[model samples]
Target: MAHCQFRLVNGPPQRYIADGVAWVLDPAVGGGGALRNLGIHGVDAALSLATGKLGLKSVSIANRIHPGPVEDHALLVLEDEAGALFIVEAGYTFASMRPGGDFEWRIVSANATLIDHGDHVICATLDDAAIVDLPVELPATRYRLFMRDTLDRLARKAPPPVSIEDYVAAMSLIDAAYQKAGP
Candidate 1:
């Protein structure tokens, strides 16, 4: 198996990586828990969502990204499955944010490039093309109950070949539903 490379970008305080595991940063929620690094395996398939919870609200595919960053990065709308929804930009030029999100980002993949921005994430590059932004939103904790619900829906209706075309189409459906729920 090929492992992805990762490099820490920037933050207020200096960050630390635990050799073969995750990135640990001081958390602000309570007793300063460390925000562990979740690598490629954590995002390989939808199942990774369960192990590495990157404060994801929901997952969706986008058809077009107009007047946004990156010619074609992931266009994700941040919505806490419980309620709160915000616009999130991923796979863009450099920055990505939910505007008012709480989760802190730490690149874990060996080759995952942390572009100097808040709303974007770029994985290993292929020749001159890179797998840019994987736009996703932060769902409320309530999504915990609906994990199987959403995951199953995606799996059952998943296209046969796991290519870009099929993946994007499915993501679009989920994205549409999220939009209907409002931002």
Candidate 2:
């Protein structure tokens, strides 16, 4: 792929409450915000599609709306050895009522560009403006599916779908971004 972009934005006013506490606003409790909570998925997705070694290009993090120890928004830019660019953006900044928030995933390659619209994907050829809609089957609740798969694997004595190495690699990137952003 020449370029890949993912955006996970929410409109919940940057505060996550559970039992009368906003634990997500606490850096120590939540580890970090936006990037750590939401952008990690994007990082994992990018890593899955990487052709070669990838390196961090830049990072921008902020808590413009809700000033706290944790950031409410983050943006990261990465580049692979093949010169492909990957951008991941996460934020609690949109204005919507949806609990899951708004999600966008787009991939641009030499032959075509694919834009994910939740239930369908639009593939447009680089040579022509023609587009094709590809239907996809998605679960209404991804968390439920994930939990079911995890439990099934455990029952079958199978290894976890996501390995510790994968988690480490993704977290290392996020740590680097935080370090680059500085205190």
| Candidate 2: tens digits of C-alpha lDDT, residues 1-183 | 899998888765444673355776677987788899889988988887887767999999988876777787899999988899999999877777466577888999998998875556789996887899987544246677889999999999999878989889889999999999998
lDDT of predicted model 2: 0.83
Model 2 CA lDDT for position 97: 48
lDDT of 1 by residue, 49-99 (tens): 223222345534332432221122233333223333332333322233333
Q: Which predicted model would earn the best TM-score?
A: 2
Q: Mark the 10 consecutive residues where model 1 has the least summed lDDT.
A: 31-40
Cα misplacement distance, residue 60 of candidate 1 (Å): 36
Model 1 error, position 175 (Å): 39
> Candidate 2: misplaced stretches above 4 Å?
13-15, 18-21, 126-130, 137-140
What number of backbone clashes does candidate 1 have, counting pairs of residues 3 or more apart or in separate chains? Answer: 30
